[model samples]
Target chain A: MFTDCSSSTTSRLIHLYNRNGVFLPRPSVSQFSLRTTASTWRCTLSIRSSSSPSAIVIDGKAEAKKIRDDIKIEVSRMKESIGVVPAEDSSEEEVLKYVSGFNDDPSVHGVLVQLPLPSHMDEQNILNAVSIEKDVDGFHPLNIGRLAMRGREPLFVPCTPKGCIELLHRYNIEFKGKRAVVIGRSNIVGMPAALLLQKEDATVSIIHSRTMNPEELTRQADILISAVGKPNMVRGSWIKPGAVLIDVGIKPVEDPSAAGGERLVGDICYVEASKIASAITPVPGGVGPMTIAMLISNTLTSAKRIHNFQ
Target chain B: MFTDCSSSTTSRLIHLYNRNGVFLPRPSVSQFSLRTTASTWRCTLSIRSSSSPSAIVIDGKAEAKKIRDDIKIEVSRMKESIGVVPAEDSSEEEVLKYVSGFNDDPSVHGVLVQLPLPSHMDEQNILNAVSIEKDVDGFHPLNIGRLAMRGREPLFVPCTPKGCIELLHRYNIEFKGKRAVVIGRSNIVGMPAALLLQKEDATVSIIHSRTMNPEELTRQADILISAVGKPNMVRGSWIKPGAVLIDVGIKPVEDPSAAGGERLVGDICYVEASKIASAITPVPGGVGPMTIAMLISNTLTSAKRIHNFQ
Candidate 1:
C-alpha cells in the first residue's frame, strides 16, 4: 500500500517502525488521526522534498495562549452543563484526594498534581495515583514507555517535549533526515525530546555528562536540543552553523542589572548561537510558555478521549 | 559511593540514565547470584585492556544450564515448603484469572503467559493483567518505560538484551565511549538492547527500515547488535574490524539437507563477520539460551523480592 502510495502524488507516508519492527506500509494521513508518519522506505529514506530555506522563530507564548483559551471555553461549557466546580487544593493529601476524584469523575478530563508538593510527600506514589487515562502530563511510566516506542501512541506526551516538538511542527522544521543531538536525557524534556525527534524520522543521539567529545557530537547535529540547566554550557563553537537550536534549559545566574538580582539563562550561549545558527529559541520566550500551553492541549485531548468527543 | 570504588581494585559501574536522566551513581555490582560485569573506568573507556587475540564464543549454553540448575533447586524448595502448584489455563479469562491469582499469591513470585495466546484474546491486555512485580518477561509498559529512561531501574531487563550485555561482561568487552549500533528496534530485542548499551556508556545509534545508508551507521560501531530477523543481511564489509557483535536475530532458513528442512541463522553473515569482528555470538547457541535463563533468573529475583529473601 505504501509503495502504491509512494508512486502517486499522495505520498504522505512518514517513516514508522511497527510493534514487530517490521517495515509495513501504513498511510500517514488517516481518518482517526492516530496516524503517525508510517513508511517502509528502506532503500530510499529521502529527506522531505519541500524546502524551507530558513526557519522562523516559533511564537510559543501566543500559541500557548490560544490553547489555554480553548481549554477555558471547554471548562466553562462543562461547568454550565454538569455543575462541575473546580476542586480546592492546598495540602498533599488534599491534592491527591482531588486527583483521585478527577480520576473517577467522567466530567474531569485531566488530572495534574503540580510539582513541588510538600517535602514530606512521596511524589512518585502520588503521581502514580493519577489515572493513566487522565495522565495529561504524560509523566506516567507507561505513557513515557509508549512515547519512547516507535509504533505506540502515548496517551499524552510530557508538555515540555510536546511543546518543543509542537514548536518545530508549527514552524515547519523538517527533521525527516536530519541528524539531531539532544544535550540531556531528562524524562521531562531531553529524553522525551529525543524520542520525539526519532518519531519524526531524524537520526537521533543523546549526549550526557559521560559523553566524550560532546562538542564534536553537537557540531554534527542539524537540529540541537539542549535541556541541561547549565547556563551557557553550549558555546557557539559546539553548534553546527544553520542548525535549528531549541533551548529548553532555563537557569538563573547572578545579574546585578536585573531587578530580581538574577536573570534567566539557557544551556546554549543564546546570544552567540542566535548569530551562528539559522533559527533558535530564546531563554525566556521559547519553551517556557509552551509547557503550560501543552498542558492545556493534553487536557483538551484527554477530555476528548475520555468523553468520546469529536 | 562509586567514587570510593573507583579508588580501589573494584571499579564497576554500569553506564546508567535516570528517570529524570540525572546521572546517578548506582552500583551495578550486586551480592545477588547473578551479577553483570558493571565497571567504572570512565578514564579507561578503552577497549578491553586484556585482549582475546581471537573472537571467543560466549558459551551461553553452559551459563544458561548453571542458572537453570540454581532456579530448579529454588523451585523445588518453594514447591516443598509452600506446596505451590502450577495453575491451569486455556481460555483468556481463565488465563487472566490464574495471573490475577498469582498476583495475589504469597508463593507465586513470577508470572509468564507464554506468547501466541488464543486468537480471540488480546495479548497486550492479558499481559498487562500480570502484576508488574512478577512480570518476569519484563514486557510491562512501566518496566519498558523505566528501561528507556535514565535514573530509573526497570524491575527486570528484557532477557535477550540482558544476555547480550552479559556475554560482553563475561568476555570483558568494554563499551564505554564506543559507538554501538543496533540494527533493529523491536521491543523484545533491539530497542532494549540499545538502552542496555546506553546504560553502559556506549554511544548508541539505532538503524531501522527508514534509515538511509544503514551500512554507514553499522560501520561506525565499536559494538554492533543486530536483532533484525533477516538472515545474513549483515556482511563482513559492514563491520568495523575488531568490533564486538551480538546477533540477536535467529531465523529458521530453509535448508533441504537439515533434518527439519530448516536451519537456524542469525542476522549477521557469521562466516564473514566472525573473521572480521573481534567477538560475536553464534546463532543457535547465543541469545536463544540466555532468554530462558533470564526468565528463571527473573523468577528467582521476584521470589527474593516477594519473600524478603536476603
Candidate 2:
C-alpha cells in the first residue's frame, strides 16, 4: 500500500534539473516508465567489504514523495475548508510594477521572480522589491538575515537547503555537537546550508575557492554538504570513515551510451565514496526532487499563513 | 603636531564602555586626567623572550582617534557646503511611531533604537521598524542579509564588527585564504564578524556553546575573534602560535585596588596570549573605542549619501 502511494506520487510530476539548478516540471506519460526503471531512482545497497562498495543510498525520490503525500492532504484540507488555493504568476512587464501588483493582490499568496533577469535589469533591485510577506522563494535579504540570526525565524527557507535539511531530519541524523563542513559559499545553497547546520547546533566551517586546504576540514566533518557544482570534486579520500554526505551539486557529463548523450554527476565521486561513507544521496534523484517538493511545501505554508488556516 | 592633534581628538569626548558594550559619553572636565594617564588607555609593548611578553599591541585608541579626525573634517565640509548635518533622536514614546517619524524626516540621516526595550515590547519588531536607509546601528535583517551575500553591499554594518574589520584593514592584516574562527554567535558581534571574515575570502568556522571542542578549532585559526562575554574564557593554550587575535568580549571583573572596585577584562587571557600571539588587541582600549568611531563614520556616510555630498 505504501509503495503504491509513493510510486503514484513520484510519477505525477516529472522534474528536470536545469543548468541553473531550478527544477522544471513536465507532465508526460512516456517519462513515467523511464523514471521507475531508471538506475537513478533505484535505492541500491551493498554489504560492507574491502572488495565491494557498501553505503546506504538515501532514496530522496521516495522521501520527497512521502513529504508530498503529506502536503497534498494538508493542502486539500486547506482548500476544502477555506476555499483558498495558492497562486503564482510570471510576467515580462516592468519588473517592479509586476512585483508590486502581486504584492498588493489579495488573492496572491506567494510571489517568486525567476532569476537571471535580462542584462539590463538590476537583479538586486528587482529582488528587493518583492514583499517580504509574499516572498515564498525566501531570497529576500530580510528572510536570510533572520535565518542567520539566533532566536529569529524566517517565514520561509530557500527550497534546496531546506530540502537538504529535511532529508537529514527524515534519516534521523544527529546534528548537535557534530562538526559539519560545507563546500562553496553561493548565497542560495552552500551559504544557507552552513547557516542551517549551525542553527541545528552543529559546528560549521565553510570551504570555498579561497580555502587553502579543504580536505583537512572535510575529513573532520561528521556531516558533509557539497554544493560547489563541480563534477566529482569530492573524492573518496575526502570522506570521513562514516560521515553522512549530502551532495547538492548536479552537473552533466558527456556519456555517449547514456540517454541524450550525457549523464548527471554530483560533486562527490559516488562509486568511490560509497565504499567509505555510511550513507549518501545520488545526483539525479537526490536533492533535485526534494527541491521541487520544498517549493510546493513553501507555497502551501504561505497560503495557510495568509488565510490564518490551521 | 600629530601627537597634539591625537590628544585633542581623544579629549573631545569622555567615552565609557558600558555593560551593554555600548559607548556612552559623559561630558566632564574631571575625567580628562583619568583618560590620559589611566593604564586602560596606555599601549604597552614588551620585548619578545622567555622572560617577557612580546606581542605587538594594536592601539585601537590611536587608530580610532585618527579615523574620527578624518570624519570630523568631512562632516564639517558637508555641513558648510550642503547645510546638512547628521541627526539622531531617542524617544520614550511608542517604538513604531517614533521610528516612522525619524524615517520620514528629511534631516535625519541615521536612526538608532537602543536595545533591551521593556518586557512588553517585541525587540525584532522595533528593530525592523527602523528604515533600512537610516539604520545607522545596522541591526536590520535586510542589511545583514546583504552583508552575507556575495556581490552585494550593505549600507551600514553593525559598529562593533565593522570596527573589528576596520582595525584589521588599518593594520594591513591579510584575510584571503586564511582560516578564522569566531567564538560566539550573537546577532550583534560574533555572527556578523564571522560573516564579514568569510566575505573577505577567509574560510570561517564559528564555535559556540554547543561546540564539542572549541579549543581544537581555535588552534587551527590564523585569525581568532572571541566575542563571547565570558571574561578570560579563551586561554593562551587555545590559540595557535603567532596568530592575530581580535578580542571583542569585555566584562567587568572585581579588583579591590581599582576605581569602583572593578576593571574590564576580555575573553582572552591577555597576559598569557600576549606571549603567544603575533599581535593582540587589549580589551578596554581595543574594540570599544573603535565601535564608537564606526558609529560616527556610518553617520557621516549616511549624511553624505542623503545629501549627495562627496
Candidate 3:
C-alpha cells in the first residue's frame, strides 16, 4: 500500500511492511488480462519471455490502483474537494494571468501548466510564473533545487520520478548502498530519478548520449532504470544477473497482432531481460499509471499543506 | 587565462589553451612563499610529498588570481560598480525584509547572506527570499533547479562548485566520458560539484557517508573530487593511478611546528596520493581561493546581465 507520505513516513511504512512479511508476489498474467482497458494497451507479460521467465513481473497498474485507493480514502476523510486550475490554448500572458488568479485563490491548492507551449511562448517563463506553493507538478526550479540539496526537502517532487520511487518503496526494494545506473539524463524522468536514488543512499551513475561504455556501467548496476524513450535500446546482455529493472520508456511499435495494430514497447528488450532480471516493470502498465497516481497524490498533499491539516 | 565565461566560452578557451601548449607548471614551493600573508595560511606544497612528487600540483591560488585579473578588466570596461548588499546577524524576518529591499533596488546586482544563520532563522527560507536574477551566490533553489536540469542554464552556479570546474577548465582536463567520483553530499559543495561534473558529460557516481565501500567506487574514478571535510580521510589506496584529484576538503589539524600551532589539510592524504595520482590540489591554496574568484566573477556577470552589457 502507498500513501502520500513523506520520506520518513515511507521508510517507516517500508519497515512495517517488511517485518510483516507482506511482500506481494508477481500476479499471474491472467490477472492482468481482466484489468486491461482501451486506454491501456494489451500485451502478454509471459509472451515476452522466450522460455519460462525467472524474474518477477512488477504489476505497476495494480500498485498504482492501490495507491489511488489509499488516496481516495484520504481525500474522502478530508471532506473537501481540492481545486486544480488548468488553462489551455492560451497565450503565455493569458496563462500567467490565470496562474496569478489561482495563486490568490484560497480554494485552489495546485496549478499545473501543460508543457510544450506554443513556439512563440517561453516555456520556462510560463512555468516560473506559477506560485511555488501550488507547484504540484514539481517542475519549479525552487522545488528541484531543494530536491537536489542534501538536508533539504522539496515541497513536491516531479510526479513521474516520485512515482518511480514509490513503486520501488511499495515493492520493498532496497536502495541503500546499491550500484544504481540511470540511462538518460532527461530533466523529467532520468535526472530527477538519479537524484532521488542518490538521496535514498544508492551509489548512482548517470549515463547519457555522451557516455562511453554504457554496457560496462550497466553491467555493474544492482538496479537499472532506463528513461531514454528509445524502444529496445537496452538488451538482455546489458543486464547483470538478478538486477532489478525499472523501464520508464514507452513507445508505440508496429504490431499487426495487437487490437490497434500497434503495441507499446520499453527501452529494455523485455523478451530477453525478463529472463535475467530479478524484477522488472513492464512498458504500458509500469511507470505510466504511476505518474497519474502521483499527480493526484501531490494535489491531495498540496491541499493538506495549504490548510495545515494533519 | 580564466574569465567569467559561460560553459561554451570556457570550452573554447580550454581548447585554445590546450592547442597553445601553455599549461602552467607547478610553481616551486618558494614562489608560493612570497604570496603567503597574514590572511592566508602558509603551507609548502612539495613538502606534502615524502619523496619527489610526480603529480602536478594544481595551483588554484595562482589560477584564481588570473581569473580575478580578467574580472578586473571587465569591471573597468563596464565602468559601473555592482552593489552587493550583505545582511548579518538579523532575525529571519529582518533578513527577508532586507532581501526584499535589495530585490527592488535597481543598483543592487547581488544579495548574499552569510551562512549558518541564527538557530531561530530558517536558512532555506531566507535563501529562497533572494530574487533569482540577483542571486549571485546561487544558493537560491531556482538557480540550483535550473543547474540540475538539462538544456537549461542557471543564472549562477554555486561558487565552490563553479570554482572546482573552472580549475579543471583552466588546466585543460578532459571531462567527457570519464568516470568521476564525488565524495560527500553537502548542498554547498559535494552535490553541486557532482551535478556540474555530470553536466560536463562525465559518467558520475556520488559516494556519501552511507556508501558501503567508498574505496571500491573511488578506485574506478578517472577523476575524483573529495569534499568531505574529514582531514586525510581519502588514502592512497583509494586513488586510481593516473587519475586527477580535486580536494575541496579543508580542515585545520594540529601541527606544533606550524605558525598558528595548526595547519590545514585536505580529505586526501597528500603524501600517499601524490605518488599515485597524475595531479592533485593542495587544500589551503586549492578550492578555497577559486571560490572567492568565482564569487567576484558571478558578481561581474550579474552586473553585465542586469545592464545588458556585452
Candidate 4:
C-alpha cells in the first residue's frame, strides 16, 4: 500500500515530544538563557558514508542529543542566575494558559505545542494561540504562507523539513536545475520540502497518491525526498543511480531478529537503495534527530531576533 | 510586448497596475456587485482550436467582459434596491481605512487593495490590515498558507492562477498525472499556479531565472504555464510537441506599425507556441481576461458565503 502511494492510505506524519520538548520556558528554566555564549556550533562533523565516498553519514542522533543537553545546561544555568519557577500546568487549558503567558513574556523567546494533542482539544486553535513571534515550530498558517510566498520570510520553518534541507546544505549537495521529486504532500514535511527545494533553484516535482505512475516519476529525480511513513516502500528500482535520497519516513516494523520484535524502518529500502543511490539518510539516525536539533536552533534564533543579538 | 507575447523584452514581471489591466476592482463599480441569483453560470463556450480539433480555444476576454457586464447589472439593481453609497477613498491611508470599514460592514462581502500601491506606502502593512474573512484577493498570508496546506481551504484564491485552473477545468483539459511546468515564482501568479496545479494531481515542476536548462525542464511538461512576464522568452523549441500551453504573461510592446505606436504581448512567443502546441491561449484574449472574471467570481462567492444566499 505504501508502495502504491495510494489515496486509501493516510499519511502518518506527526510531531513527537520528549515529555518536556513542547512547552518551553518551563518556569523551572532560567530567564538568563541564550546569554551570548560563543561556543562552536559543532553543527556537524562529516563522516564519510560507508557506502559511498561522495556521501557522508549524517549522525543526527548525536547532534540532537548534544542540542538537548545544551538546552538543559542553559536552562539550569539560567535558573541559578535568574531564579524563576514556572507555574504548574495541570490541564490542557492550563497548558494553553501557560503558553499564552509565555507569549507576552519577553524572556520566553519561543513557544510550541506538541502534535497529536489528546483528541479533545482543537489543534489549530492551540497552534494559532502561539504568538507569531514566538511560534518556533512554524506551524502557524501565517508563517507557512510567508514561507511559500516570494520576498517573504517565515519567522521559523517547520523542523523536520528544515532538517532535511539543513542536511543537504551541511553536506554540500548541489540540486540546482536538477529534477527533484518529493514523495508525499503532508503540510508539515512534503509541501514545505518542495518549497525549500524550489528556493534552492532545483526543478521540483511533487509525487502524491494521485500520481498515475509514481515509480516512473520518481526514477527521473536527481534528488528524491520520501516522507511517507511506510517502511521500505521505495525500492532500488524507484531511484535513479547516483541520486541523493533524503528519507524522512520512520515507522516501527516487525522484526523477530531484534531485541524487541520490532525495528524502525524508513520509507526507502535502505539496503538495496544504498547500492544505487549516491547518498541516503538512514531511518533511526536520519531526519528524526535533526528535527529536535532544528527546534532548539529555531528557539535560539528566536531569542537572538527578540534580543537583537548577532 | 502586450499582444505578441512579444520579443520586445520589457515585461520583467513586476506586479502591475490598472493602467495595463492587471489590477481589477475599480471603485466606480457598485458595492452590490455579486448578488447571487442562481442562473446557469455561462462560464465557457469553448471554441475548438483552428489548428487542432482536439484542442479548445478558451475565450477568456469575452467571458470576463460578460462577467463585468453581469456584475454591473446586479450591482446597479441592488444599489437601487438597498440604498447604501460607498464613500470615496483617495490616499493610501484612506484606501486602507475604506477597506477596513468594508471589513466590519457585513454588507461588504469582499475587500481588495489594488496592487502596485504608490511608492511611499508599506504594502504589507496595508494588506495585513484587511480582515481574513473579507480578503477577496487571497493575497493575505493566512489565505495563501491555507491554499498551500493539504487539509485546509482558502476563502478565496488569487485570480490569475485560479483562472488558469478554471480554464483547464472548464475546457476539460486533463491535469492528473500530467507533467506540468510552471515558469516563474512570483507569489501572485507563478507560485500559486504551481500549487493549484499540484492540487489538481499534476506532478508539477517550477522553472525560474536561475534554472540552468529551462528548455530541458519544460520539454518534459505535458502542460506548460508561463507567467514570467518576460516578453516571448519561451521559444517554440522549448515546448514539447502537443503540450497544453497556458501563457499568463502580459506586457505592452512598442510597435511602429500600430496607430498607438504600441501593442499588447505576453510571456510566450504565441505565434511560435501556437504552431507547436496542440492547445494555446492567445496573449491578449487569454489569462488576462480570466483574472478579472475570477475577481468578480471570488467576490460573488464571498457574498454567498457571508449572506448564505445560495
Candidate with top lDDT is: 2
| Tens-place lDDT digits, model 4, residues A1-310 | 1121212222222222122232211122112111111111111111122334444456667767777787667555644655532222346687678778879888775675655465767778778788876676887777788889978888789999999988887678897777799988888899999988988878788887666667776898889999876555576678899899999977665444456855677777665577678888977898898897887667656544544444
The 0-to-1 C-alpha lDDT of every candidate, in the order given, reads 0.68, 0.74, 0.73, 0.68
The runs of at least 3 residues in candidate 3 whose Cα sits more than 4 Å from the true structure, single-residue gaps closed, are: A1-47, A80-100, A105-110, A113-134, B1-46, B80-101, B105-134
Q: In what order do the candidates fall by lDDT, top score first?
A: 2, 3, 4, 1
TM agreement with the true structure for every prediction: 0.71, 0.76, 0.74, 0.73
For model 2, which pairs clash? none
Q: Which wins on TM-score, candidate 3 or candidate 4? A: 3
Clashes of 2: 0
Give the candidate number with the greatest DockQ. 2
Query: Candidate 4: which stretches are off by over 4 Å?
Result: A1-55, A69-97, A103-110, A114-136, A302-310, B1-56, B69-98, B103-110, B114-135, B304-308
DockQ of each: 0.33, 0.63, 0.57, 0.49
What's the residue-level lDDT of B23 in candidate 2?
32
Q: Which tens-of-lDDT digit does each residue in A64-125 have in candidate 1? A: 78778877888777667665533323566776786787788887756765454557777898
Clashing pairs for model 3 are none
User: How many pairs collide in each candidate, listed in order?
Assistant: 15, 0, 0, 13
* Best-matching candidate per TM-score: 2
Candidate 4: residue B273 Cα off by (Å): 1.8
Two-way DockQ contest, 2 vs 4, winner: 2
For candidate 3, the chain B TM-score comes to 0.73
For residues B1-310, write the lDDT of model 4, one tens digit per residue: 1222223223222222242433311222112111111111111111122334343456778767877787677656545755432222356677678677778887775676545466776789878898876676888777788889987887789999999988878678899778899988888998999989988878888888666667777887899999866555576678898898998977664455546855666666665566668887887898888897887777656544444543
Q: For candidate 1, write residues B35-114 as lDDT tens digits.
A: 11222112211112233336666667877887789778887777687765232236778768867987999777567654
Give the true-contact fraction for every prediction, in order.
0.43, 0.80, 0.82, 0.69
> By DockQ thresholds, what CAPRI class is model 1?
acceptable
